[model samples]
Target: MTEMLAHELRTARAPISAHLFVSGFTYTGMISSWLPDKPDAACTSEETVSHLVERLEHGDFYILCPDNEVTPEIDRKRVAWAAQDIIENRPALSRWHPDFAERFAAFEKPDRNVEKV
Candidate 1:
């Protein structure tokens, strides 16, 4: 899944300086490895998206949307909600709607503690 997301990002010509792969949904290590620097950040989906948007506004880097149901067009509200969940250190999965959970289940994996993030 990580590889797929990375490939999509690369194909889209998004910047590679820094990127965030929202954890708690999928545990693909590719994004962590692709980052130019160590993975010093981890957050619920919302916080990650918020930071990504800030970075995008500042021209810090480009944001890549993983091929999930959360399209960028509808992600503004989702990102804000995710940001709050992350800041509170809550499990992102808990916030998903019932319909999304059904689709997201295919991507779930055992939680692996990342030593760096």
Candidate 2:
């Protein structure tokens, strides 16, 4: 069996509260980078979305959406904020953000044990 399988995102609340949507990647630094580096640091997407929702519903989630009402302008801001937050939150993924290279190291430090010699 393959180690990975795909799952669709389902939310109990229709039109997932924008806060929740932003909270996932906002806190977790996308599905890829966040999980491996910080083994003890558990985030929602590291597990099934169902499991994530369970925790979130139980008050485990903490991102606040100051503006919950959706409007065209808000939608634009949401997308922009999420994008900026994603890049800023994870230094490893900062390359994705243009005009912000100085905010992150040019490249991750080489693994300690690797040697050119």
The candidate scoring highest on lDDT is 1
Model 1: ten consecutive residues of lowest lDDT: 108-117
Which pairs clash in model 1?
46-82, 46-83, 47-82, 47-83
Candidate 1 local lDDT, 52-85, one digit each (tens): 6776677543354433344443344445545655
For each of the candidates, the C-alpha root-mean-square deviation to the true structure, in angstroms, is: 16.2, 16.0
TM-score of 1: 0.27
For model 2, the run of ten residues with the poorest summed lDDT:
1-10
lDDT of 1 at 63: 55
Reference-based lDDT, each prediction: 0.47, 0.38
TM-scores of the candidates in the order shown: 0.27, 0.23
Each model's backbone clash number: 4, 0
State the lDDT at 34 in candidate 1.
Answer: 63
**Which lDDT tens digits does candidate 2 get at residues 31-57?**
446455634433444343554566567
